[model samples]
Target: MKSMTGYGRSSFLCENVEVSVEVSSVNKRNLETVVSLPRDWQALEREILTLTKEVVSRGRINFSVKARVDKAERPEASWDEKRLRDDLEQLRIFAEAEGIPYHPDASLLCRLASGQKFEQSLPDPTKMTEGLKQAAQEALKAMIQTRIEEGKHLEADIKARNAEITCLVNELEVSSEGISALWREKLLERLRQAELELDAEDERVLREVALFAERCDVSEELTRLRSHGELMNQILEEDGPVGRKLEFALQEISRELNTVASKSPSTEVKRLVIEARAECEKIREQALNVE
Candidate 1:
Protein backbone atom coordinates (compact mmCIF):
# COMPACT_ATOMS: atom_id res chain seq x y z
CA MET A 1 0.00 0.00 0.00
CA LYS A 2 1.18 3.48 -0.85
CA SER A 3 -0.18 7.00 -0.60
CA MET A 4 -0.44 9.32 -3.62
CA THR A 5 1.17 12.30 -1.93
CA GLY A 6 4.88 12.81 -1.31
CA TYR A 7 8.02 14.78 -2.22
CA GLY A 8 11.59 13.90 -3.13
CA ARG A 9 14.64 15.79 -4.35
CA SER A 10 18.04 14.67 -5.63
CA SER A 11 21.17 16.31 -7.02
CA PHE A 12 23.83 14.87 -9.27
CA LEU A 13 27.22 16.23 -10.13
CA CYS A 14 28.36 15.46 -13.67
CA GLU A 15 31.78 16.83 -14.51
CA ASN A 16 31.60 20.62 -14.06
CA VAL A 17 27.78 20.66 -14.18
CA GLU A 18 25.49 20.18 -11.17
CA VAL A 19 21.97 18.96 -11.87
CA SER A 20 19.16 18.93 -9.32
CA VAL A 21 15.72 17.39 -9.70
CA GLU A 22 12.74 17.73 -7.40
CA VAL A 23 9.62 15.59 -7.74
CA SER A 24 6.43 16.18 -5.80
CA SER A 25 3.02 14.56 -6.02
CA VAL A 26 -0.56 15.06 -4.83
CA ASN A 27 -3.56 12.75 -4.85
CA LYS A 28 -5.27 12.53 -8.22
CA ARG A 29 -7.53 10.12 -10.01
CA ASN A 30 -4.90 9.43 -12.63
CA LEU A 31 -1.23 9.82 -13.38
CA GLU A 32 -0.58 13.35 -14.63
CA THR A 33 3.03 14.54 -14.71
CA VAL A 34 4.24 18.02 -15.55
CA VAL A 35 7.93 18.64 -16.13
CA SER A 36 9.73 21.98 -15.79
CA LEU A 37 13.17 22.04 -17.30
CA PRO A 38 15.49 24.61 -18.79
CA ARG A 39 14.92 25.50 -22.41
CA ASP A 40 18.25 23.94 -23.34
CA TRP A 41 17.14 20.62 -21.83
CA GLN A 42 13.53 20.71 -23.12
CA ALA A 43 14.29 17.86 -25.53
CA LEU A 44 14.42 15.47 -22.56
CA GLU A 45 10.88 16.28 -21.37
CA ARG A 46 9.38 13.14 -22.86
CA GLU A 47 12.01 10.95 -21.26
CA ILE A 48 11.34 12.49 -17.88
CA LEU A 49 7.61 11.99 -18.29
CA THR A 50 8.14 8.35 -19.16
CA LEU A 51 10.39 7.84 -16.18
CA THR A 52 7.73 9.32 -13.89
CA LYS A 53 5.08 6.96 -15.23
CA GLU A 54 7.41 4.03 -14.66
CA VAL A 55 7.92 5.04 -11.00
CA VAL A 56 4.44 6.23 -10.06
CA SER A 57 1.09 4.68 -10.86
CA ARG A 58 -1.22 7.51 -9.87
CA GLY A 59 -1.00 11.16 -8.83
CA ARG A 60 -0.52 14.68 -10.16
CA ILE A 61 3.27 14.74 -10.21
CA ASN A 62 5.34 17.85 -10.85
CA PHE A 63 9.00 17.45 -11.76
CA SER A 64 11.46 20.34 -11.84
CA VAL A 65 15.04 20.18 -13.05
CA LYS A 66 17.65 22.84 -12.43
CA ALA A 67 21.15 22.74 -13.83
CA ARG A 68 24.13 24.93 -12.92
CA VAL A 69 27.15 24.53 -15.14
CA ASP A 70 30.54 26.01 -14.28
CA LYS A 71 31.54 29.10 -16.21
CA ALA A 72 34.08 27.08 -18.22
CA GLU A 73 31.46 24.45 -18.95
CA ARG A 74 28.73 26.92 -19.97
CA PRO A 75 28.11 27.39 -23.68
CA GLU A 76 29.10 30.88 -24.76
CA ALA A 77 26.68 32.94 -26.82
CA SER A 78 28.32 34.10 -30.08
CA TRP A 79 27.31 35.87 -33.30
CA ASP A 80 28.30 35.78 -36.99
CA GLU A 81 29.89 39.25 -37.33
CA LYS A 82 30.15 39.08 -41.13
CA ARG A 83 26.51 38.04 -41.56
CA LEU A 84 25.37 40.80 -39.17
CA ARG A 85 27.28 43.50 -41.06
CA ASP A 86 25.98 42.34 -44.47
CA ASP A 87 22.35 42.26 -43.24
CA LEU A 88 22.72 45.71 -41.73
CA GLU A 89 24.12 47.14 -45.02
CA GLN A 90 21.33 45.49 -46.99
CA LEU A 91 18.72 46.94 -44.62
CA ARG A 92 20.18 50.44 -45.01
CA ILE A 93 20.22 50.19 -48.78
CA PHE A 94 16.63 48.99 -48.87
CA ALA A 95 15.51 51.86 -46.62
CA GLU A 96 17.37 54.45 -48.74
CA ALA A 97 15.81 53.08 -51.95
CA GLU A 98 12.38 53.36 -50.33
CA GLY A 99 13.05 57.07 -49.48
CA ILE A 100 12.94 56.30 -45.73
CA PRO A 101 15.40 57.71 -43.21
CA TYR A 102 17.53 54.85 -41.87
CA HIS A 103 19.38 55.16 -38.56
CA PRO A 104 21.93 52.28 -38.54
CA ASP A 105 23.49 52.02 -35.09
CA ALA A 106 26.11 49.66 -33.57
CA SER A 107 23.82 48.70 -30.66
CA LEU A 108 21.04 47.75 -33.09
CA LEU A 109 23.47 45.59 -35.06
CA CYS A 110 24.64 43.89 -31.86
CA ARG A 111 21.02 43.11 -30.78
CA LEU A 112 20.20 41.70 -34.18
CA ALA A 113 23.30 39.55 -34.13
CA SER A 114 22.37 38.12 -30.68
CA GLY A 115 18.89 37.11 -31.93
CA GLN A 116 17.93 33.56 -33.07
CA LYS A 117 19.53 34.20 -36.45
CA PHE A 118 22.87 33.68 -34.68
CA GLU A 119 24.00 30.16 -33.71
CA GLN A 120 24.31 29.55 -29.92
CA SER A 121 25.80 26.10 -29.45
CA LEU A 122 24.64 24.37 -26.27
CA PRO A 123 26.39 21.72 -24.14
CA ASP A 124 26.53 18.14 -25.42
CA PRO A 125 22.93 17.01 -25.78
CA THR A 126 23.68 13.34 -25.18
CA LYS A 127 25.48 13.96 -21.88
CA MET A 128 22.87 16.43 -20.63
CA THR A 129 20.01 14.15 -21.60
CA GLU A 130 21.50 11.15 -19.84
CA GLY A 131 22.34 13.19 -16.72
CA LEU A 132 18.87 14.71 -16.51
CA LYS A 133 17.22 11.32 -16.95
CA GLN A 134 19.30 9.75 -14.24
CA ALA A 135 18.61 12.56 -11.80
CA ALA A 136 14.87 12.37 -12.48
CA GLN A 137 14.80 8.61 -11.95
CA GLU A 138 16.58 8.97 -8.61
CA ALA A 139 14.23 11.67 -7.45
CA LEU A 140 11.19 9.66 -8.47
CA LYS A 141 12.48 6.61 -6.61
CA ALA A 142 12.93 8.68 -3.46
CA MET A 143 9.43 10.14 -3.77
CA ILE A 144 7.95 6.65 -4.13
CA GLN A 145 9.82 5.51 -1.04
CA THR A 146 8.43 8.42 0.91
CA ARG A 147 4.90 7.63 -0.24
CA ILE A 148 5.33 3.97 0.70
CA GLU A 149 6.49 4.92 4.20
CA GLU A 150 3.48 7.17 4.65
CA GLY A 151 1.29 4.34 3.42
CA LYS A 152 2.57 2.11 6.20
CA HIS A 153 1.08 4.48 8.74
CA LEU A 154 -2.17 4.75 6.82
CA GLU A 155 -2.39 0.97 6.49
CA ALA A 156 -1.93 0.57 10.23
CA ASP A 157 -4.59 3.12 10.98
CA ILE A 158 -7.02 1.46 8.59
CA LYS A 159 -6.32 -1.94 10.08
CA ALA A 160 -7.00 -0.61 13.54
CA ARG A 161 -10.29 0.91 12.42
CA ASN A 162 -11.20 -2.37 10.76
CA ALA A 163 -10.59 -4.16 14.01
CA GLU A 164 -12.84 -1.72 15.81
CA ILE A 165 -15.55 -2.36 13.25
CA THR A 166 -15.24 -6.11 13.80
CA CYS A 167 -15.53 -5.60 17.52
CA LEU A 168 -18.68 -3.55 17.00
CA VAL A 169 -20.11 -6.24 14.77
CA ASN A 170 -19.57 -8.81 17.53
CA GLU A 171 -21.17 -6.53 20.08
CA LEU A 172 -24.17 -6.05 17.81
CA GLU A 173 -24.52 -9.83 17.47
CA VAL A 174 -24.58 -10.25 21.24
CA SER A 175 -27.04 -7.40 21.64
CA SER A 176 -29.24 -8.78 18.88
CA GLU A 177 -30.12 -11.92 20.86
CA GLY A 178 -31.27 -9.82 23.77
CA ILE A 179 -33.16 -7.52 21.42
CA SER A 180 -35.06 -10.48 19.96
CA ALA A 181 -35.99 -11.76 23.47
CA LEU A 182 -37.12 -8.32 24.51
CA TRP A 183 -39.30 -8.02 21.41
CA ARG A 184 -40.94 -11.35 22.14
CA GLU A 185 -41.72 -10.33 25.74
CA LYS A 186 -43.03 -6.95 24.65
CA LEU A 187 -45.28 -8.51 22.02
CA LEU A 188 -46.75 -10.91 24.58
CA GLU A 189 -47.35 -8.07 27.02
CA ARG A 190 -49.19 -6.07 24.37
CA LEU A 191 -51.37 -9.06 23.53
CA ARG A 192 -52.24 -9.58 27.21
CA GLN A 193 -53.03 -5.88 27.64
CA ALA A 194 -55.56 -6.25 24.82
CA GLU A 195 -57.33 -8.97 26.87
CA LEU A 196 -56.35 -11.53 24.28
CA GLU A 197 -56.77 -15.14 25.46
CA LEU A 198 -53.96 -17.66 24.83
CA ASP A 199 -55.68 -20.29 22.67
CA ALA A 200 -54.73 -22.78 19.98
CA GLU A 201 -56.14 -20.35 17.44
CA ASP A 202 -53.48 -17.79 18.59
CA GLU A 203 -50.73 -20.04 17.25
CA ARG A 204 -51.04 -18.39 13.86
CA VAL A 205 -50.51 -14.93 15.38
CA LEU A 206 -47.47 -16.14 17.34
CA ARG A 207 -46.03 -17.74 14.22
CA GLU A 208 -46.56 -14.51 12.29
CA VAL A 209 -44.61 -12.54 14.92
CA ALA A 210 -41.86 -15.14 14.81
CA LEU A 211 -41.67 -14.84 11.04
CA PHE A 212 -41.45 -11.06 11.30
CA ALA A 213 -38.63 -11.43 13.82
CA GLU A 214 -36.78 -13.75 11.46
CA ARG A 215 -37.11 -11.28 8.60
CA CYS A 216 -35.70 -8.51 10.77
CA ASP A 217 -32.79 -10.63 11.93
CA VAL A 218 -29.33 -9.32 10.92
CA SER A 219 -27.29 -12.47 11.50
CA GLU A 220 -26.76 -12.94 7.80
CA GLU A 221 -25.70 -9.33 7.45
CA LEU A 222 -23.25 -9.71 10.30
CA THR A 223 -21.82 -12.79 8.67
CA ARG A 224 -21.39 -11.05 5.34
CA LEU A 225 -19.89 -8.01 7.06
CA ARG A 226 -17.29 -10.23 8.71
CA SER A 227 -16.48 -11.80 5.38
CA HIS A 228 -16.13 -8.40 3.78
CA GLY A 229 -13.83 -7.29 6.60
CA GLU A 230 -11.59 -10.29 6.03
CA LEU A 231 -11.44 -9.58 2.32
CA MET A 232 -10.62 -5.94 3.02
CA ASN A 233 -7.77 -6.95 5.26
CA GLN A 234 -6.43 -9.30 2.63
CA ILE A 235 -6.57 -6.63 -0.02
CA LEU A 236 -4.71 -4.17 2.15
CA GLU A 237 -2.05 -6.72 2.80
CA GLU A 238 -1.50 -7.53 -0.86
CA ASP A 239 1.49 -6.22 -2.83
CA GLY A 240 -0.07 -3.87 -5.34
CA PRO A 241 -2.69 -1.19 -5.97
CA VAL A 242 -5.96 -2.29 -4.29
CA GLY A 243 -7.83 0.92 -3.74
CA ARG A 244 -10.50 0.11 -6.27
CA LYS A 245 -11.05 -3.35 -4.84
CA LEU A 246 -11.25 -1.99 -1.33
CA GLU A 247 -13.74 0.60 -2.50
CA PHE A 248 -15.88 -2.11 -4.08
CA ALA A 249 -15.81 -4.12 -0.89
CA LEU A 250 -16.82 -1.07 1.07
CA GLN A 251 -19.82 -0.56 -1.19
CA GLU A 252 -20.90 -4.15 -0.68
CA ILE A 253 -20.61 -3.81 3.07
CA SER A 254 -22.58 -0.57 2.97
CA ARG A 255 -25.34 -2.20 0.98
CA GLU A 256 -25.62 -5.04 3.47
CA LEU A 257 -25.65 -2.65 6.40
CA ASN A 258 -28.39 -0.62 4.77
CA THR A 259 -30.50 -3.77 4.39
CA VAL A 260 -29.91 -4.66 8.04
CA ALA A 261 -30.86 -1.21 9.26
CA SER A 262 -34.02 -1.09 7.16
CA LYS A 263 -35.24 -4.47 8.37
CA SER A 264 -34.35 -3.94 12.02
CA PRO A 265 -37.38 -3.45 14.25
CA SER A 266 -35.46 -2.90 17.47
CA THR A 267 -34.05 0.58 18.07
CA GLU A 268 -30.84 -0.90 19.53
CA VAL A 269 -30.19 -2.99 16.42
CA LYS A 270 -30.79 0.01 14.15
CA ARG A 271 -28.34 2.09 16.20
CA LEU A 272 -25.68 -0.60 15.93
CA VAL A 273 -26.20 -0.86 12.19
CA ILE A 274 -25.81 2.87 11.83
CA GLU A 275 -22.56 2.76 13.79
CA ALA A 276 -21.22 0.07 11.52
CA ARG A 277 -22.16 2.08 8.45
CA ALA A 278 -20.36 5.10 9.82
CA GLU A 279 -17.17 3.09 10.30
CA CYS A 280 -17.42 1.69 6.81
CA GLU A 281 -17.80 5.21 5.46
CA LYS A 282 -14.61 6.27 7.18
CA ILE A 283 -12.79 3.34 5.68
CA ARG A 284 -14.10 4.28 2.27
CA GLU A 285 -12.76 7.79 2.64
CA GLN A 286 -9.33 6.46 3.54
CA ALA A 287 -9.36 4.04 0.64
CA LEU A 288 -9.62 6.95 -1.77
CA ASN A 289 -6.05 7.91 -0.96
CA VAL A 290 -4.65 4.46 -1.53
CA GLU A 291 -2.79 3.44 -4.67
Candidate 2:
Protein backbone atom coordinates (compact mmCIF):
# COMPACT_ATOMS: atom_id res chain seq x y z
CA MET A 1 0.00 0.00 0.00
CA LYS A 2 1.08 3.58 -0.62
CA SER A 3 -0.28 6.97 0.47
CA MET A 4 -0.99 9.77 -1.96
CA THR A 5 0.45 12.55 0.18
CA GLY A 6 4.22 13.10 0.57
CA TYR A 7 7.10 15.55 0.09
CA GLY A 8 10.69 15.40 -1.24
CA ARG A 9 13.56 17.64 -2.28
CA SER A 10 16.95 17.44 -4.04
CA SER A 11 19.73 19.89 -4.90
CA PHE A 12 22.50 19.67 -7.51
CA LEU A 13 25.45 22.06 -7.60
CA CYS A 14 28.57 22.47 -9.80
CA GLU A 15 31.18 25.24 -10.16
CA ASN A 16 29.04 27.61 -12.24
CA VAL A 17 25.47 26.62 -11.33
CA GLU A 18 23.35 25.21 -8.49
CA VAL A 19 19.86 23.80 -9.01
CA SER A 20 17.32 22.35 -6.58
CA VAL A 21 14.11 20.43 -7.04
CA GLU A 22 11.22 20.05 -4.63
CA VAL A 23 8.22 17.75 -5.03
CA SER A 24 5.04 17.58 -2.96
CA SER A 25 1.90 15.50 -3.32
CA VAL A 26 -1.57 15.21 -1.87
CA ASN A 27 -4.53 12.84 -2.06
CA LYS A 28 -6.51 12.92 -5.29
CA ARG A 29 -8.64 10.53 -7.30
CA ASN A 30 -6.43 10.96 -10.34
CA LEU A 31 -2.85 11.87 -11.05
CA GLU A 32 -2.41 15.61 -11.64
CA THR A 33 0.99 17.30 -11.77
CA VAL A 34 2.17 20.90 -11.91
CA VAL A 35 5.76 21.97 -12.52
CA SER A 36 7.57 25.26 -12.02
CA LEU A 37 11.12 25.78 -13.25
CA PRO A 38 13.48 28.53 -14.35
CA ARG A 39 12.34 30.13 -17.60
CA ASP A 40 15.63 29.08 -19.22
CA TRP A 41 14.83 25.48 -18.22
CA GLN A 42 11.16 25.64 -19.17
CA ALA A 43 11.78 23.35 -22.14
CA LEU A 44 12.73 20.56 -19.77
CA GLU A 45 9.43 20.67 -17.89
CA ARG A 46 7.87 17.98 -20.07
CA GLU A 47 10.61 15.51 -19.28
CA ILE A 48 10.19 16.11 -15.55
CA LEU A 49 6.45 15.63 -15.77
CA THR A 50 6.97 12.38 -17.60
CA LEU A 51 9.29 11.16 -14.88
CA THR A 52 6.69 12.06 -12.24
CA LYS A 53 3.99 10.11 -14.05
CA GLU A 54 6.25 7.09 -14.09
CA VAL A 55 6.71 7.21 -10.31
CA VAL A 56 3.26 8.24 -9.16
CA SER A 57 0.02 6.92 -10.61
CA ARG A 58 -2.33 8.71 -8.16
CA GLY A 59 -2.22 12.09 -6.38
CA ARG A 60 -2.21 15.83 -7.01
CA ILE A 61 1.50 16.53 -7.33
CA ASN A 62 3.20 19.93 -7.19
CA PHE A 63 6.89 20.51 -7.90
CA SER A 64 9.27 23.43 -8.29
CA VAL A 65 12.90 24.09 -9.33
CA LYS A 66 15.22 26.83 -8.14
CA ALA A 67 18.61 27.65 -9.65
CA ARG A 68 21.57 29.93 -9.01
CA VAL A 69 24.25 30.52 -11.61
CA ASP A 70 27.50 32.53 -11.67
CA LYS A 71 26.96 34.59 -14.83
CA ALA A 72 30.57 35.89 -15.03
CA GLU A 73 31.91 32.34 -15.28
CA ARG A 74 30.03 31.65 -18.56
CA PRO A 75 31.64 32.22 -21.95
CA GLU A 76 28.50 33.90 -23.24
CA ALA A 77 28.72 36.61 -20.54
CA SER A 78 32.41 37.46 -21.20
CA TRP A 79 32.85 41.02 -22.56
CA ASP A 80 34.06 41.31 -26.22
CA GLU A 81 36.42 44.21 -25.31
CA LYS A 82 38.78 43.71 -28.33
CA ARG A 83 35.95 43.57 -30.86
CA LEU A 84 34.22 46.61 -29.32
CA ARG A 85 37.48 48.66 -29.40
CA ASP A 86 38.22 47.66 -33.00
CA ASP A 87 34.74 48.78 -34.14
CA LEU A 88 35.12 52.06 -32.23
CA GLU A 89 38.51 52.73 -33.88
CA GLN A 90 37.08 52.07 -37.37
CA LEU A 91 34.14 54.41 -36.69
CA ARG A 92 36.50 57.15 -35.43
CA ILE A 93 38.64 56.87 -38.59
CA PHE A 94 35.56 57.11 -40.80
CA ALA A 95 34.41 60.25 -38.97
CA GLU A 96 37.93 61.89 -39.31
CA ALA A 97 38.03 61.12 -43.04
CA GLU A 98 34.53 62.54 -43.61
CA GLY A 99 35.49 65.70 -41.59
CA ILE A 100 32.34 65.30 -39.40
CA PRO A 101 31.96 66.23 -35.69
CA TYR A 102 31.39 62.71 -34.09
CA HIS A 103 30.24 62.20 -30.51
CA PRO A 104 30.68 58.72 -28.93
CA ASP A 105 27.93 58.75 -26.35
CA ALA A 106 27.70 56.55 -23.21
CA SER A 107 24.76 54.64 -24.76
CA LEU A 108 26.90 53.34 -27.66
CA LEU A 109 29.72 52.43 -25.33
CA CYS A 110 27.34 50.47 -23.04
CA ARG A 111 25.76 48.72 -26.02
CA LEU A 112 29.16 47.72 -27.39
CA ALA A 113 30.42 46.68 -23.93
CA SER A 114 28.83 43.20 -24.20
CA GLY A 115 27.16 41.31 -27.03
CA GLN A 116 24.18 40.16 -24.95
CA LYS A 117 24.34 41.25 -21.34
CA PHE A 118 20.75 40.27 -20.51
CA GLU A 119 21.29 36.66 -21.46
CA GLN A 120 22.53 34.70 -18.37
CA SER A 121 25.24 32.05 -18.40
CA LEU A 122 24.16 28.41 -18.33
CA PRO A 123 25.53 24.92 -18.84
CA ASP A 124 24.87 22.87 -21.97
CA PRO A 125 21.11 22.62 -22.56
CA THR A 126 21.17 18.89 -23.18
CA LYS A 127 23.14 18.13 -20.03
CA MET A 128 21.07 20.61 -18.01
CA THR A 129 17.88 18.93 -19.17
CA GLU A 130 19.17 15.57 -18.11
CA GLY A 131 20.31 16.99 -14.77
CA LEU A 132 16.88 18.48 -14.15
CA LYS A 133 15.23 15.15 -14.85
CA GLN A 134 17.66 13.36 -12.56
CA ALA A 135 17.09 15.77 -9.70
CA ALA A 136 13.33 15.50 -10.01
CA GLN A 137 13.55 11.73 -10.12
CA GLU A 138 15.56 11.67 -6.91
CA ALA A 139 13.00 13.87 -5.18
CA LEU A 140 10.21 11.66 -6.47
CA LYS A 141 11.94 8.60 -5.11
CA ALA A 142 12.03 10.14 -1.63
CA MET A 143 8.41 11.21 -1.82
CA ILE A 144 7.36 7.68 -2.77
CA GLN A 145 9.34 6.28 0.14
CA THR A 146 7.49 8.56 2.53
CA ARG A 147 4.16 7.56 1.01
CA ILE A 148 4.95 3.88 1.47
CA GLU A 149 5.82 4.45 5.11
CA GLU A 150 2.57 6.31 5.71
CA GLY A 151 0.67 3.61 3.88
CA LYS A 152 1.85 1.00 6.32
CA HIS A 153 0.26 2.99 9.11
CA LEU A 154 -2.96 3.42 7.17
CA GLU A 155 -3.16 -0.29 6.38
CA ALA A 156 -2.74 -1.26 10.00
CA ASP A 157 -5.36 1.20 11.20
CA ILE A 158 -7.83 0.14 8.53
CA LYS A 159 -7.27 -3.51 9.34
CA ALA A 160 -8.03 -2.93 13.00
CA ARG A 161 -11.22 -1.07 12.08
CA ASN A 162 -12.17 -3.90 9.75
CA ALA A 163 -11.93 -6.30 12.63
CA GLU A 164 -14.23 -4.06 14.60
CA ILE A 165 -16.76 -4.11 11.78
CA THR A 166 -16.58 -7.88 11.61
CA CYS A 167 -17.18 -8.18 15.31
CA LEU A 168 -20.24 -5.96 15.00
CA VAL A 169 -21.54 -8.10 12.19
CA ASN A 170 -21.16 -11.20 14.29
CA GLU A 171 -22.90 -9.53 17.21
CA LEU A 172 -25.79 -8.52 14.98
CA GLU A 173 -26.10 -12.04 13.64
CA VAL A 174 -26.27 -13.60 17.08
CA SER A 175 -28.79 -11.05 18.32
CA SER A 176 -31.09 -11.53 15.32
CA GLU A 177 -32.46 -14.86 16.52
CA GLY A 178 -36.20 -15.00 17.50
CA ILE A 179 -36.73 -11.61 15.90
CA SER A 180 -39.76 -12.90 13.96
CA ALA A 181 -41.54 -14.17 17.13
CA LEU A 182 -40.93 -10.88 18.87
CA TRP A 183 -42.28 -8.91 15.91
CA ARG A 184 -45.38 -11.15 15.81
CA GLU A 185 -46.08 -10.58 19.51
CA LYS A 186 -45.71 -6.84 19.07
CA LEU A 187 -48.08 -6.88 16.11
CA LEU A 188 -50.74 -8.72 18.16
CA GLU A 189 -50.30 -6.24 21.03
CA ARG A 190 -50.86 -3.36 18.64
CA LEU A 191 -54.07 -4.99 17.37
CA ARG A 192 -55.29 -5.47 20.96
CA GLN A 193 -54.66 -1.83 21.70
CA ALA A 194 -56.72 -0.91 18.61
CA GLU A 195 -59.71 -2.90 20.09
CA LEU A 196 -59.57 -5.60 17.35
CA GLU A 197 -60.23 -9.25 18.21
CA LEU A 198 -57.62 -11.65 16.71
CA ASP A 199 -56.47 -15.05 17.87
CA ALA A 200 -52.71 -15.35 18.33
CA GLU A 201 -52.65 -18.74 16.52
CA ASP A 202 -55.12 -17.81 13.78
CA GLU A 203 -54.33 -18.95 10.22
CA ARG A 204 -54.17 -15.32 9.03
CA VAL A 205 -51.92 -14.33 11.93
CA LEU A 206 -49.64 -17.35 11.25
CA ARG A 207 -49.41 -16.47 7.59
CA GLU A 208 -48.59 -12.78 8.40
CA VAL A 209 -45.85 -13.82 10.83
CA ALA A 210 -44.32 -16.21 8.27
CA LEU A 211 -44.30 -13.49 5.62
CA PHE A 212 -42.73 -11.01 8.01
CA ALA A 213 -40.07 -13.54 8.98
CA GLU A 214 -39.20 -14.14 5.37
CA ARG A 215 -38.99 -10.41 4.74
CA CYS A 216 -36.69 -9.92 7.74
CA ASP A 217 -34.41 -12.86 6.97
CA VAL A 218 -30.89 -11.36 6.68
CA SER A 219 -28.99 -14.58 6.04
CA GLU A 220 -28.17 -13.66 2.46
CA GLU A 221 -27.10 -10.16 3.45
CA LEU A 222 -24.85 -11.58 6.14
CA THR A 223 -23.34 -13.98 3.68
CA ARG A 224 -22.64 -11.20 1.23
CA LEU A 225 -21.21 -8.89 3.87
CA ARG A 226 -18.79 -11.54 5.06
CA SER A 227 -17.82 -12.27 1.48
CA HIS A 228 -17.19 -8.58 0.88
CA GLY A 229 -15.04 -8.35 4.00
CA GLU A 230 -12.94 -11.25 2.76
CA LEU A 231 -12.63 -9.62 -0.61
CA MET A 232 -11.44 -6.43 1.04
CA ASN A 233 -8.69 -8.42 2.69
CA GLN A 234 -7.77 -9.97 -0.61
CA ILE A 235 -7.51 -6.58 -2.28
CA LEU A 236 -5.30 -5.23 0.50
CA GLU A 237 -2.89 -8.06 -0.14
CA GLU A 238 -2.56 -7.38 -3.87
CA ASP A 239 -0.25 -4.67 -5.32
CA GLY A 240 -0.78 -1.45 -7.37
CA PRO A 241 -3.33 1.34 -7.20
CA VAL A 242 -6.36 0.06 -5.25
CA GLY A 243 -7.88 3.24 -3.84
CA ARG A 244 -10.75 3.47 -6.31
CA LYS A 245 -11.34 -0.26 -6.19
CA LEU A 246 -11.38 -0.23 -2.43
CA GLU A 247 -13.81 2.68 -2.49
CA PHE A 248 -16.18 0.70 -4.69
CA ALA A 249 -15.83 -2.42 -2.56
CA LEU A 250 -16.64 -0.46 0.58
CA GLN A 251 -19.75 0.90 -1.10
CA GLU A 252 -20.92 -2.63 -1.73
CA ILE A 253 -20.11 -3.63 1.82
CA SER A 254 -22.05 -0.69 3.17
CA ARG A 255 -24.99 -1.55 0.95
CA GLU A 256 -25.15 -5.06 2.33
CA LEU A 257 -24.97 -3.74 5.88
CA ASN A 258 -27.76 -1.29 5.12
CA THR A 259 -29.91 -4.18 3.89
CA VAL A 260 -29.23 -6.06 7.08
CA ALA A 261 -30.14 -3.01 9.16
CA SER A 262 -33.45 -2.55 7.36
CA LYS A 263 -34.58 -6.20 7.61
CA SER A 264 -33.80 -6.77 11.27
CA PRO A 265 -36.49 -5.86 13.85
CA SER A 266 -34.39 -6.34 16.97
CA THR A 267 -33.08 -3.16 18.61
CA GLU A 268 -29.87 -4.97 19.56
CA VAL A 269 -29.28 -5.98 15.98
CA LYS A 270 -29.95 -2.43 14.77
CA ARG A 271 -27.46 -1.05 17.26
CA LEU A 272 -24.83 -3.48 16.08
CA VAL A 273 -25.57 -2.59 12.48
CA ILE A 274 -25.08 1.09 13.26
CA GLU A 275 -21.67 0.39 14.80
CA ALA A 276 -20.69 -1.71 11.82
CA ARG A 277 -21.73 1.04 9.45
CA ALA A 278 -19.65 3.53 11.40
CA GLU A 279 -16.59 1.32 11.08
CA CYS A 280 -17.18 0.98 7.35
CA GLU A 281 -17.42 4.76 7.09
CA LYS A 282 -13.99 5.09 8.72
CA ILE A 283 -12.55 2.59 6.31
CA ARG A 284 -14.02 4.51 3.38
CA GLU A 285 -12.46 7.73 4.58
CA GLN A 286 -9.04 6.09 4.82
CA ALA A 287 -9.32 4.69 1.31
CA LEU A 288 -9.20 8.22 -0.08
CA ASN A 289 -5.52 8.46 0.92
CA VAL A 290 -4.62 5.15 -0.68
CA GLU A 291 -2.94 4.57 -4.04
TM-score of each: 0.78, 0.80
Every candidate's lDDT:
0.80, 0.84
By summed lDDT, which 10 consecutive residues of candidate 2 come out lowest? 114-123
Model 2, position 198: C-alpha lDDT score:
98
Candidate 2's residue-wise lDDT over 32-83, tens digit each? 9999876556788889889988878999999998876665665556665777
**Model 1 weakest lDDT span, ten residues long:** 115-124
Across 117-172, the per-residue lDDT of candidate 1 in tens digits comes to 32243455567777777778788889989899988988998898888888988987
Clashing pairs in 2: none
- TM-score for model 1? 0.78
**Candidate 1 local distance difference test against the native:** 0.80
